[model samples]
Target: MSQPVMPAPIGKRGRAALGMDAQDLSTITERAGDGLRVLGLRFTNDRGCPAERFETLRARLGTSFEGIEIDSSPGNAAGIAPSAHAVLTVSLVDEPGHPTRVALDRVVAFLAEQLRH
Candidate 1:
């Protein structure tokens, strides 16, 4: 069985964009109130995704997944995972034409719009 891996601890830029400070990310999550969560992702081959790709996704997500818990494992999926209120996945592998960029843009637009409400 593959052990679940925690995403990197939220960085300073992410926290700032999320309007959070030194407090624990989990604690921030607890106070978020029924926000969207990107949990239960299973990576491919039981191996972790590349750190650079993960960080890219994290940076792209910005405050979209802020205060929300995210979890991952080893599995597979298509290039994009779109949720009702957010973009759930990005192309972990680099592809021609840069579909990841488009996905990230959708994520930012969707969640930023949600935040306005």
Candidate 2:
């Protein structure tokens, strides 16, 4: 995968999925020798479509996810530009304890979110 300098993560800044919301993010720690190392990734605006928005989002998200690591540098510089959507790909340091999956369990148990409501 590319480094944090790959693209600039940008979009609507809110409690969206895969964002700062407790419902969207998760944390993972890997064992590196004698200490633990948390993982980090670069999130760009998908592209540089809205340069201004990307900058704002990158700045805001710079320190949003506390437990999780994020990298924002490589802003889109091709046909791909910033947009309001993203294809999710989450890698966890461990299994069965990730927050995203735990939330999903609740949804699955109810068959539908409306049932939980």
Any residue pairs clashing in model 1, and if so which? 42-74, 42-75, 43-73, 43-74, 43-75
How does model 2 score by TM-score? Answer: 0.20
Tell me, by TM-score, which candidate is best. 1
| Candidate 1: residue 60 Cα off by (Å) | 21
Q: Write one digit per residue (lDDT tens) for candidate 2, span 3-79.
A: 23223434453222232344322221112222322223223442422333334334334433122112223453222
Cα lDDT tens digits, model 1, 4-114, are: 233432554332232234364455455443553332222322233223333433454444332222222222133333221122334333453333334444456765876
User: Whole-model Cα lDDT per candidate?
Assistant: 0.35, 0.31
Error of 1 at 75 (Å): 15
TM-score of each: 0.27, 0.20
